[model samples]
Target: MVVQESGTPRELEHHLRPSTVKGIDFDQLLEPLAATAHGAANKRPITGVSLNPQIVQPGDVFLAISGAKRHGAEFLDTAIANGAVALITDEAGLNLLAEPASIPVAVVSDVRKIAARAASMVYGTAKNCPELLAVTGTNGKTTTTFMIRAITEALGLHAGLVGTIEMSARGQIIPSVLTTPEATQLHGVLARMNEQEISTVAMEVSSHSLSYGRVDGLQFAVSGYTNLTQDHLDLHGSMEDYFQTKAQLFTSGHSQRAVVMVDDSYGQRLAQNASIPTESLSLDAHTNADWHVVNIAPSVLGHQFTIVHRDGREIHARTGLPGLFNVANAALATVMVLASGVALEQLQEALKQADPLSVSVPGRMQVIGESPVAVVDFAHNSDAIAKALESMRVTGQGRRIIVFGATGDRDKTKRPDMGAVAARHADIVIVTDDDPHGEDPEPIREQVAAGAQAVIDAERAAVQLFNIAPRAKAVEFAVSLAGVQDAILVAGRGHEVSQDVAGIDVELDDRVELANALKLHGFVTIY
Candidate 1:
């Protein structure tokens, strides 16, 4: 089917639900698999499916997938009591059910691989669901998705967005716990968007999602790559493995076409090795690319740039989002729109009229104050922290002071790298607690502080370091030290509302705390 134009329906809704599952038999569906099941013949039909035992309802098939903590099959009794009509899991999970006859058990070897498609069968795909556009990268995924939504809406189309911040559609927004939801919830969200008459959607596809089978079996009309940096090594083990996992989205099964930003080596290789039709975008003038950005002007209000395609079409774009990196992000979003079948001319016109800064994703280079400039961003990685600090330095005149921290139990190796970046870039560095999930907050801070101390002592840099465990106090201290010409950057948790400390979500907002600190110091900001 051709991509639908703004205000035009591409196709009529065939069925409200994508599939007919009046009473899908469990045994029949599992018959093709080699999994051994003693009660295969006795399994009954199921009306729905769920992986989490906590949310299982009547007639739902509780999918007991194995996991690191404990096999999901361990929760079989919990699922059965919650009205699960049948169980679809591996041979191990089937063995967990003490009384297999209480509920039908059908074994599947690979639960993660089949969970998404199973959802597609039960809930049915949304009617006239918007063409799926997936964006994957180390950063900019959230910003780009929000950008696509802005550009799409500017064209008089209702577009839905699913990302780290929220899952929004039908005039409703829900806070998100994960960057990308698991397969069942992800498809359910997509179907919900379809029902809401959203003709287009932009979803942030995470590397973890790709590797864990979260995005398995979903179709994407177009997918995109922003850039890969050194983060998530804890989960993937090595940078090469991380890159390969991100590269999987560019293949035919996950996406139909790819729009890749070739500014980095990983991106360049991705463009070269992409299995599907690909479009190359670049910010550098000397590089050979299909989409080229030639000019960038950064101001206190943000930046403006120009983009030229291989067809000789040049378009002007502007963003209130500070930093030259945003120019790359805006350019990436521009091509994504074109790849989705929007007329390039239409997109160009929208860029001309739309306020790109107004489309900013929260906690992403979020400016909370101006005089003694205060900024908050989700720059937890070393590379991202460096870029964010540099972006803030150039935005306003004067010395830079950074308030940042590394999370616990996730990619511990990046902690020192982040500290070193802050030490080198900021005149003053405040090391604070980020998200110390289950681990003692002290060790994480010490590792990061050691990196900062190392850099400071190595160069005999005048950068002063303060180890502050309480994030709120850290913001206050930074604000107390800031002058009118200085910028205070609070990194790590951009839009996050709470601090994850020892497995508990402690309520803390950098923006709120920063604002309060500024107010306490009798300082007024341009914000």
Candidate 2:
């Protein structure tokens, strides 16, 4: 007998305001948008928002946003031909002459920002369904968001995930390029989740997304802070600016609560200054933290720990994820899950029934070998590099070598910092290429080399440092240097299957290459 797949009923179309010939006062909203558009109009009218030309129905407003290498407004004619009732754009877009059309064009200043606000107004329905919880930090945002989704699902609620890895709404997974999607796409996803009865949204709010106004009008019920480290400086200009951008989600608009992990200085600062009530978490750190992790021990499998919430309430838990730092990340996730109204009993039961959470966090201290242990991680910053190295040093009984590189066109200031951390922590260090996009590989390597050299010159540190570019070669060399008892940690790229060079993505899996390099050296594993 044939079986049919189960599916939900289709939802109705989105709500759109009717268009009227009598122009309305575009005064309150578009004044800033109009000034940026260089268009003077107090009575300009707009009907609806439409980004896609092919799907644009009659009496809809067509928007043209500037893309990486092109402008979205270039497709204005296509949108019009497809039945756009009104045009929403800046002066450059309005100036594009087309045959006399019957539609009215509403010119706004700061088109991107205005479009975001407009889209949220048009499509945002977070209030009608489950509360939206926004998670923002330099690190742990992805893991925390996914963990919250797990806990929410354990409580039998439909939870949606939006982050760097992928998006999950009502059991459908879609790949994403940006950590936080464009306002139009984000609102559209949330609206679909709302329709599908997925009440809770756990989203990663990136610094770039916050500064660019991607989540302009999102009404987050609670916002969590994991911690801040040196990252994304190329976009934010300074660490202060980057922290301020991340803080926007916790303090801005309609965020009601701030769940912060105060182990980092920035997290503590955010909690102290938060407008809303804040819950703080720390792992053996001396702080007036509201939530804390204690009784920690590491096993070959993972770490076990107990989390103490406010009022001395404690839950014994063990995560399959590795390292002590991850325990802190788990604590942040746990606190947020509890704050989401999941009962303590449900949280404890879910922790027990769910698959061990360790070895599940991607590129996070993932071990691939035993004798000559090979680990892969996405630790690109100084603190993260330090944590990964420390974890390896303690976990590995013998020599520990680290292979890593600083990413090009991104926070170059951290190159030396990362090098210093690696050199000081590991027994051997290999500085290699990491996405030297559009930058000279030698200079990038030289910067990291200087950092390692600085650490070596200052003190005869544990790690012997070397530099090699064209990342694959460095990995090959690092593997060759390893012995039976030595571990080689390939850092910076973890579970990343591609290498980006001068703006081109090339297939390069560090883990696979590491294994191949081991095979070339006649090292075979018996599991």
What is the Cα-based lDDT of residue 294 in candidate 2? 87
Q: What are the TM-scores, per candidate, against the unseen true structure?
A: 0.91, 0.85
lDDT of 2 at 221: 77
lDDT of 1 by residue, 1-527 (tens): 22322221111111112233455666655554444455545455666667888767666778889998899988888878877887778877766766755665667778877787776666665333568889999988888899888888888898888889877764556656588887877776677677677889889999889988888768788898999999888889999999999999998888889999998999999999999999999998877789998878865558887888888988788888877777778888878888889887887778777764358678888887877778888888987888888887533547799998888889888888888889998989999899899989888999999999999999847899999969999999999998888988999889888987777778998888988998999888544
State the lDDT of candidate 2 residue by residue for 329-380, as single tens digits.
7777778877767778878888777732442555666666666877788887
Q: Model 1 off-target regions past 4 Å?
A: 1-45, 126-128, 393-397, 525-527
How far is each candidate from the true structure, as Cα RMSD in Å? 5.6, 5.8
Worst 10 residues of 1 by lDDT: 7-16
Where model 2 places Cα greater than 4 Å from the true spot, the runs are 1-60, 66-71, 78-85, 96-103, 124-126, 393-397, 522-527
The total of clashing pairs for model 2 equals 7
Candidate 2 lDDT = 0.72
